[model samples]
Target: VAEWYALVAAPGAMEAREPLRDLRGALRAMLARVRGGRRDRVGLGRAEPTLRWLRSLSAFTEGEPGEGREPFELPRFWDALDQTFKVTSQEATKLSLAFSRPPLTSAEDCRKLSEDVQNAILAVATVYYWLPKGQGTTLRKMVRDATTEVVKGMIQLTETILSAPLESLSQEQLISTGGVWEACEQVSNLPRDNQAAVASALAACLGVVKDALEEMEHALVEGQDPYSDIVEDEELGFRGNRDTYWSEADRKLLSSCMGLMKASKACLKKVLAVVKAYGKADSPEQIAQLDDLADIANEISPSVDELALSMYPPMNQLAVRLNAAKLASVLKKVLEITKTSHVCPPSEEGWVQFLTGAVDHNMNKIKNFTQGQL
Candidate 1:
């Protein structure tokens, strides 16, 4: 019960290295108290099995260390386990005395009581000793059997928590920084104060949208196919008309933008992972490969941004509907580093088609929202 409470109330504490020290302290105290007792207090019959168990535990604990083992040395760990074995045996004696054999009891009852007491003592001894031995084979099986019912009780509670919806998040809280706010201000024509307030709110919403999309993407990558609330949110927003003069072209730009963005993040993840595995490549070819990848990611960024602009050139009498400049600059720097010199500028046809589709989607959503406001 104490172990269970420790697990429940302070699960994080289990991760720290000091618990073994506490166990050692408890064992030492138990040993001091037990030694003060009369020599014959624990009979030979009781003492023999207890001593054998302690020896087994000590042998296992003092064995040669394995690679990447925990910091606690084998000797110290063995001493601690040996002490705990003594403590558990002492407790078992008290229990045995309290439930002493009845003189006239049936032979079966006496046998069963003895077996129960022995099993209890063994179980406690096994756990105390096995922990330092790195997932003991026999002990794990015993613990699994003992904790099965307790674990079952926790299942429903765990399920409820796991199934719960993500907590509500404001737009400002979702984004990493105020970059989205600046973009919103550039695009929206609201009065200064209104734009400031609305952009702050919208930036937060955009941040949340980005986070939700990332979660979905990650889940998809992991083969989890998480059910998402983003689709519902998207449907509730204004739908744009795709037939506008530049919609087709503008959408192509957005596609390029997305590709460059994804590639940048992907390349970086790969580079970091490679560095971790191989540890600073010394060869020129290896260094070149890493450098080339980085440059390619950078170059792609600008090309996509340019595509976005060409597709959505400012219309006469109409303010620009998008801001693609900042994104373009990021891409230019990437291209310079990759220095692949072979650039895949956004294809005109592809840009036109992409812009057409995006404009249609955005216009329909926007029209729907405007009508509702009326």
Candidate 2:
């Protein structure tokens, strides 16, 4: 049995070896108890058969017993394993009951319970691994159902931690990021198809939330705006202006641009909620809502971009007239709009370059006009 385990653990094993490792460890522990004379003769007799079956199973190992023997068939091997160690509906039901209970109090107790839960999940997954293509036997269905329930339980626990306020979360919970996603990844390795979809949803949900948290930290803690330096340069140019003359149309245009940016920010806030809910969306209706939300987000970006671009020509004309104060006011408004919009730029430097380019062009035009006048 140990040799069989060694072969399974060795490099280039054709199949997943996790369950085999667990099974081997359990068998070794059982053997130790038997050697200690803790189990009765009947227990030893039952274990002997299983041990002999495992020994026979070891023959499927790569280059085992002889050099030119027939290659091991993976399906046949899994089928034999399933027949030897059946996972009955009763076992799955008992596990389901245990998993449904509230979490334990102590850390040690929780760790032990977690191990048992993992073992139960692995047992169900083993049975799932051997199921014939498109075949839905009662026992196989029971195992799959149990696996789903257990996975859902794991997701709920992980989300409970993730959804909580960060300051209120325990150190352990904070450190255990991606727990649900990792569990889903393990389940995705099973032969079942829906496991992949579940894994994808969990991953997307976690990714969106993590990104939002990072963005929030950047905005709040860092007190840094990626567009700050560019806006400051434009502000300096505006401050250097000698004229204070203003027009009603200029005021209206500035007001309209600021209003459009504020509206875009509101739309972005709504899109964020949709993004957060997308992972938890189960039904077709909820999925359709996410699609609609995505469409709204896509629509808002271009509209806001158009509004930002519209201010450029007018601000440029003002700059040419040496109306530095109005130009400065428009640039300041642009900075305020960009900061409030929370729209990430296409690149690391963001839209600052685009905004500053317009200002630079106006400055060059003013410089040329003065030179021509002289």
Candidate 3:
């Protein structure tokens, strides 16, 4: 009867509480039958005590292995051989302490019982440490839990860009794909006087893409077990119904962050093409147009910041977040490279070097961001 209860209490042991409760009742009846001479009828000692011993052993083994292993007991016949084959370093000391008194044989059982008690105590402590720090802080706890999902999104986006083909993309396909290119063109085509409108539309698109990327990356980064922090709030602890709601909340947050990243990447690529084209111009009016490209680059700064903010746990360092700002600075440098070429160095080779550094520095930044380091 106790062995049956042991099986039921094991992690993920019974499919439902109803099964466990039913099993418990059945076990109690079996114990009553054993005490009522049913086992003697079968010519074996009453099974109640033996069953209880096995159950005690089962409880002693939980979480100690740190890996998957079934809960079971060895026959007492093998106990001596098992002890001889592998006496642990502490076994002698443990045995000596157990045999220190008249009831010394009970020492081993007492040690196992002590271990079982310690395991149970530690389990509760682990859960308490993960829980919200204060009373009525359920919302804050939820947000902290949700942040893991957000970081997963950013990690996914980084992988996507890392694996992106370096080969040049088709201009026609880029524009028609309704991704970053299309969004960029839309921003560019707006009336010159409506700079605010252009910024708004670009910003909105960037926002969606950046958010989506963050969520997608976060999903790929993996998460700690949600039940790890679960503690018994007495009757309030069994809120299993909240699982779906919490999962849905995670999905929404991840989706929003990924979308924002996607849009930002697209718009930035389009703005880069425009900058490259404008950089080749010789007239003062054309050179002044570079300022507009710089303005667009500045607008994308928030999305970069968002991406960095979402990469956590792995890339919690400020240097990692600063890479995005460095990329933006590099883009600005590209513009300045074009602007100052005729004035300072007075040589085309010097300008070429500046352009080379712009590309090389930004590429390094991308590499660091993708690797979740700085």
The candidate scoring highest on TM-score is 3
TM accuracy, model 1: 0.19
Candidate 2 wrong stretches, greater than 4 Å: 1-248, 274-279, 313-374
lDDT, model 2: 0.37
Ranking 1 against 2 by TM-score, winner: 2
Ranking by TM-score: 3, 2, 1
Compared to the true structure, candidate 3 yields what TM-score? 0.23
Residue pairs in candidate 2 whose N, alpha carbon or C atoms collide under 3 angstroms: none
User: How far out, in Å, is residue 208 in model 1?
Assistant: 16
Candidate 2 lDDT over residue span 84-165, tens digit each: 2232222323323332333312334333443453444344333344443222222233334434544443434433433332
Q: In order, what lDDT does every prediction score?
A: 0.34, 0.37, 0.36
Question: How high is each candidate's TM-score?
Answer: 0.19, 0.22, 0.23
Residue range 252-299, candidate 3, lDDT tens digits: 333333333443465454444334332333343443344344444554
Pitting candidate 1 against candidate 3, the one with the higher lDDT is 3
Model 1, CA-based lDDT = 0.34
